[model samples]
Target chain A: MPIPLIQLAGVSKQYGDVRAVDDVTLELEPGEFFALLGPSGCGKTSLMRLVAGFETPDAGRVLIDGRDMQGVPPYRRPVNMMFQSYALFPHMSVERNIAFGLVQQGMAKGYIATRVAEMLRLVKLEGYGARRPEQLSGGQKQRVALARALAPRPKLLLLDEPLAALDRKLREETQFELMQVQRDLGIAFMLVTHDQDEAMAMAQRIALMRSGRIEQIGDARAIYERPASLFAAEFVGEINLFEGEVVQSGEGKFAIVQGGGRIALADDTPLPGPVRIAVRPERMVMSHLRAGSYAEFAGVIADMVWLGDLTVWRVRLSDGRLIRISRSNADAANAAFSRGDQVFVGFEAQSARMLLS
Target chain B: MSLVKKTRGVGDGGLAANLGRRLVLIVPYAWLILFFAIPFLIVVKISISVQRDGRPPYEPVFELADGFIGAWESVQKFSMESYAAIYADRIYGDAYISSVWIAALATLCTLLIGYPLALAMARAPRRWRSLLIVLAVAPFWTSFLIRIYAWIVILKDEGLLNHALISTGLISEPIHIYATQGAVLIGIVYSYLPFMILPLYNALEKQDTALVEAALDLGATPFAAFRQITWPLSMRGVIAGCLLVFIPAVGEYVIPDLLGSDEVLMIGRSLWDEFSTARNWPGAAAVATVLLVLLLVPIVAYQRSHLQTHGAAR
Candidate 1:
């Protein structure tokens, strides 16, 4: 393929004893929307800083458009970042804040002014150029940050929790706005966020980080459907995991797991002494009785939670294993299940993603 | 309880609170009138009075029979003699100009030394910040006069600094640093450094570090980032620190008397000469009034700008 727009090979950064980024290796295509998703202190922000040239890797090379970026300072790098705090210059007007990067680049005054106006228009903050950051609301500040970071037209744009400061309602709206901007501007975005749903909604590809290492790297759907490990399986969404040992295997693909009970799995490793049979809550089907031919486990509905569009049923097995089952609320008018009711939970063989690690 | 009773209780509390508020507001005004406004009025009265060989050193004109008419008579007795002397004499003019220049230089020196120190303390690790603040403020705990005396020992001809330099072969002869304008400047800058640093540290510490990082991310060099982001943001602190150092340094007596040479003819020294050596109370009071008037300009400017910045921050 035409050389990736950004590349990292065995990149690592250490803070005293803690490895903030441990051997992280990834690539992004031109105009790709990527995300680094993890909990706090997972080094996703550290990795973003590495790409922005604010950090120097201890182990590996970072490349932009196939050029090695070793020893490059932040100012020399072709990257921009939207800070989590939306660190707009409080002393400068919104237009001046956006034009700062262009001014630094020694751009013509007329060109800088036009670009600033265009950026303001792009972020839908027209006529807000003269207003200071302190005068703007939180959502307005976020837009100004976005417009300012985009004003420089760098090869890459890094966003550190860009939508986190906004409320849920505004966050959702800005998420789509950010996506539209990314698509229209055609600049690669590497967003760092702790919110899983945000990552799943925005990023085409996401790398889930844990303690400075990426546990899994794939499209959001693929990562969710086939998590590489138990951590990955549980981190992205709710997963009912059954810990077991491999007792049987056939065709070098499927394996049968024996824990307190047996669980058959398809599309799994042939050799697996100990593993966990993972299934997403939404993937499991719940009924009053065990279905024929499908892998089924009988349990009682221990708890129920009505979540407006979906209802989650907490099923406790005879072996004292708790599993969650999610169902759509399309038939909310005809509610059939409640707490302390007998239920049978089942999932297809293909859905039992066997996490080996 | 009945609504009428609740309303009555609130009314009673409101009256008491209004009385308390009025009392609180009157205290400062009363204090200012007694200590500052009244003393300044007395100085102005003395500044225009005639000097006599009496106890108070100036003619005390009072007539109770005339009442308000007596106050008008006292005003008529007032003369522009002392003010005319100040205008005709070049010494007072030179003293004023020199005082301003010296105070300005000391303020500049303090900023130069204090900004980096403040920046470093601000950027220091969290565990070190409290200790750094304590260290910066440690000088204030000792007596200010004792601190100036300590500087004398350091700057004397056979002082520790000269001895060290001579022993290290850096210089053969001792340098005369004490009782010089440079010595006075050094004393002022050293004494007032904490004033500059504390404000700077508070401002820099409270700044959002992400602003600087964002500047760097926008392709500005490190120095450029500091100039564009850090400096402008910390300007309020700079103003506060400069005012703190400059105002007091203008009328400073101890540092100048103890460390400065006769060549250093600051207004404080001039006022001391006019009052004690020359025994000209009217001349001294006139000089003091002029100095107060000059100081008021910056004090007012500082208050106005401070209010404006606080408003903008909100």
Candidate 2:
């Protein structure tokens, strides 16, 4: 395997009473797009800052290209960060801002000029070299900031909530621009974002942070379909959970019974206590006619919302438990169910996963 | 009935707003016309008039006449004798030259001292920044005369500064600082230190700290970051602080009178001698008018540049 471009080993940091970043160990390979995904105050930004050398870890080491970065100041570190605010120098022109790092490194004036010109074109901001930061629009300023950070061409680039300041349309467009830049440069990119959709769209792998610790790290599909804990399941996407007892745990698949519904899991282990069955909302089929092929659940549609792309159905079981099911509005017939219709919801055995705590 | 009332309300509101906007523009301008502009024109008129031994100590350059021809004849009687007299006397030249030099030096000293303090206050933790700022301008809360008097107690021959120097063996004997140019400079810097720091802090505090961090993240050293980013960005503050210190320091009367030696002559002291002691009102007016013309250029330039950049910022 190729050596990782950056490695964080059991890093931890705290501010007064709050543990901003607990023990987190992660690795990024060359040209890898990694994301630290969490909500505000969850320590994802702190972890990125630690790697950028803005904040030192209280314990543990941050390794950049296999070198210890303990005593290295932010200026000396090879890592660069694109600040969330963009932090473009208002007094400087776009060309000067991009050339700042090269000039600091004492690069030749001729070389620096060409490099700045190249960066402007890379971010699709050609012919905008002489404009001051205040003269640019929000999206234009963001592109200038990206060009500035990438001018030095460091081994790894750190981004702290880079897209949070942009409008929705601009953010979507910039996401692809950022990925293209990373691909063209062939450097590892680490981003911190509270937006799950952004993380899913951009990063190849995501580490979900919860109160300074990584709860789970995997691809979006793995994290969404196979959650290891209840927090992971609820955080990534919506799921309908049913608590039940595992009565038969002999085969690889365990059988769980709750109320009048029996669910068979494809993969499970014997649990010390009762287990819960987690089923994704879109996995279950809802219909007025009961299918006799599998163990089916009969429920009444308690509430319904006709969204433009999908229809959300709230199904109440015979035992008074409510389960949310979403069906695509692909056809008019699929969304014909009303709030008072009697419906039978059923899922395949492969879709139900046993959740044991 | 409601629709009629709403339309009338809207019309009245728009009319009231228009009147309010006009009032906002008129008040300050009217104040300037009444106080600053007329008095300045009167001074200019007196500066060109001949001095005489009378109650007003000068001849009126323009006196209202019975008709247009008489008014034209009266206006033609204006003299350049006062300006010629100022040009002939080397004392007036010396006073103007010395004031500019002394004020320039004092302004430089205040800037060198104020920039660091303002930067420190701006970079300090948010909670402590307010306290530091308050302490920096705390001397302004007291009476100006009392503040100057308080400095006398600290810089005297047997004062606390001399006593500490002697006690610490940093000096061999008491120095003659109370009646020297050093004393005058000390007083000017102490008095105007707040003026320098306040504007600098205002400018520096408004700057986003993330700019400095971005510089560092771009691989610029701490000092380089300061030179490339902080220094250029805070230049407006530096210019403002220098102007605040330099303009008033040139014509300072109280500090020079209290702290300066007999040899250190300034335009303010010269104007005072001509007005109060010698009672040459026209000559003093000429001196004041010349000084105003000299200072007006810089003030207008400063305002013009500020307007240009402030428009760009918006």
Interface RMSD, in order shown: 1.0, 1.0
Candidate 1 residue runs with Cα over 4 Å from true position? A249-268, A331-334, B1-24, B62-66, B172-174, B307-314
Score chain B of candidate 2 by TM-score. Answer: 0.91
> lDDT per residue, candidate 1, A1-357, as tens digits?
699999999999999999999999999999999999999999999999999988899999999999999988999889899999999999999999999999999999999989998999999999999998989999999999999999989988999999998999999999999999999999999999999999999999999999999999999999999889888988998998876666554543444444333545544355757767888998887778767555578889999999999998899998998989888899663288899889778777777887777
Which portions of model 2 miss their true places by more than 4 Å? Answer: A247-257, A266-270, A291-296, A305-310, A318-321, A328-336, B1-12, B64-73, B310-314
DockQ for candidate 1: 0.80
- Residue B152, model 1: Cα distance from true site in angstroms: 3.0
Q: Cα deviation in Å at residue B209, candidate 2?
A: 1.4
Residue pair clashes in candidate 2: none
lDDT tens readout by residue for model 2, B127-222? 999899889989889999998888788889998889999999999899878878888899999999999999999999999999999999999999
Looking at model 2, give its docking quality level. Answer: medium
- Model 2 accuracy (lDDT, Cα): 0.88
